[model samples]
Target: MKQELTELLCRKSFKYSEEPAFKLVSGRMSKFYVNCKPTTLDPRGMFLAGHLVFDAIRTANVTGVGGLTFGADPIAVAAAFASGLKDQPIQAFSIRKTRKDHGIVRWIEGDLTPGQRVAIIDDVATTGGSTIRAIERARSEGLDVVRAVVLVDRQEGGLENIREHVADVSAVITRDELVEQWTATARP
Candidate 1:
């Protein structure tokens, strides 16, 4: 089922065209980029992912999900939708890279109280820096983080680094799995 999820994401990504380039958080550049926005931000895929997330969370005994903005946004949205479908009910939250200089001057978004148990969800985990930062912010804001779920894991030591801060890290696909699948199919 997780493999199905990864394949779906790979198919959903919008390919780059003309002078294509991307600087991944892993510091790797490739002409082929997985523009997840096409898959995650879409209506159908979004709905499907939401249901999948809700199913996974049913066993985690978790209450909420959150992470840094952008990459994590889609999954958080999915969680929100799935929560409704599962009748499990969960909220999505967002963390800022830094506190805003103005307005509410907030760092965490959503209904975060000082001692809520929440889960972290993101599209990808490369270096784990962003995940760590989000966890830190969540802790400071008083949330008991149960675990994390990344749509794709770069298999680049990110999982280990994240363990220091969060309960556990789960991924639908790892970097090795991605490479293996890509290689297996490319040998035409």
Candidate 2:
């Protein structure tokens, strides 16, 4: 399953460049990019993502899964959706970058409450800023962030930084792994 998902990501989402390396949100430059949305939003990608995440958290017994919106939205929904299919439903939640200022006037959306155990997730972790922010928000809301997970870890100190706050941190795949796969496929 892991191999299948990695191949899917490499074929459907990963991109590489050497001339003007890809510019990252963190202001860093890289020779490759992993736009997981193409895969995460795909039907098969969604299924694999959800099932993979469900398997990762199955033994953890977290009440919910979530992270910063946009990036984490589909992944969280997919996982929650998969969990339900397995009869062990876990709720989904999303955290906004800022408060709505109107309506609910809150930062978090969905059926999340204080003091629940959740695993924070992100599409990719370059510097871990977004993931950490999500963790901060979760903590502020009184939720216990038991795990930090990402679809891809760029391995650029993001996971290491994340480990400073959360004891358990992991990624489904890494940038290096994708690069290797991409390189292999590119060969004659």
Candidate 3:
């Protein structure tokens, strides 16, 4: 089941899974790019990943799931839906790159209550800067961010930085493993 979940996520995240010279949001030459919308926008991929993520966080006992907007949005939504299916629906939220000037004037979105345990999600992690900011916003709102769940970890310093605060992180695949599998299977 776990292997199946990983395979589907790899196939669906084609932007990163198939490309090798993606220009990352960090302005660095990423070995790959992870545009998870392809998967999130697909029903099968979303349901599979949602169930897997929810089960993964079962031990974490998280009250909410969220992270930086854009990439993490779909994953957070999926997890929240899975939680609902399990009859333990969890709150979902997001962190914007910058706070909107009008209306809410908040950097963080969703129900912003204090002291909730949360798990952060993202499509991919390379430097962890964005993830860190998300964590900061959540913490500032008094959310106790317990762990991070990423679709892919680029096997760079990103995981290290996140671990400084989260200690334990979950990912569907690492850069090394993804390349290894793709190389072995990608048709010529």
Candidate 4:
């Protein structure tokens, strides 16, 4: 499953260059770029990602899975769906980038309550800033963030950085793995 997902990402989402040509969210130029939405939104990609992420957190005893919106949304939903299919039944939640000012104002939107155990997820971790923010917001809302998961680790210390907040941190795929698969497929 991992192998298949890697190939799909390499073909549909991962991009590479001999020189740093891609601008990251952190405003840094990178030789590699990955926009997982193209892959994560696809049926097969969703299936692979759902199963993989669910496998990663199924035993963590978390009642919910989620993270900052947009990037983490699809993966979280997919994982939650996979969990239900597998009979684990974890809920999916989304954290807003801006605080809601309306009635029942909160940073998160889901069927979760204060103190519910949950895992934070992200599509890509570059500086771990977004995931860290998600973790902080989750904590602020009184959710117990026990684990963090990255769909793709940029291999640029993001996971290491995330580990500081949550001891249990993992990535389904690394930038290196995508690069390797990309290189292999690019060749004759």
Best by lDDT: 4
TM-score of each: 0.82, 0.94, 0.87, 0.98
User: What residue runs in model 1 are displaced by over 4 Å at the alpha carbon?
Assistant: 14-22, 26-34, 183-188
- The most accurate candidate by TM-score is 4
For all candidates, the clash counts are: 1, 0, 1, 0
* After superposition, candidate 3 runs with Cα above 4 Å error: 15-20
For every candidate in turn, the CA RMSD to the true structure comes to 3.5, 1.4, 2.5, 0.9
Off by over 4 Å in 4: none
Candidate 2, residue 22: Cα displacement in angstroms equals 0.8
9: Cα error in model 1, Å: 2.0
Ranking by TM-score: 4, 2, 3, 1
lDDT of each: 0.73, 0.88, 0.77, 0.96
lDDT of 2 by residue, 1-188 (tens): 77778889999999888664888886768787888899999999998988887788877779999999888899999999999999999999999998788986777887878888999999898889999999998898889999988989888899999989898899998888988888889755
lDDT tens digits by residue: candidate 3, 67-122? 89888888788888999999988888888888878986777888757888889888
Reference-based TM-score, model 2: 0.94
Q: Residue-wise lDDT of candidate 1 within 1-188, one digit each (tens)? A: 55655566656762332353877756777544555667778776677666666665657777788788988888787878788776778888888877877877778888767788888777777678888888888888888988887766767677888888875677766656655555555534
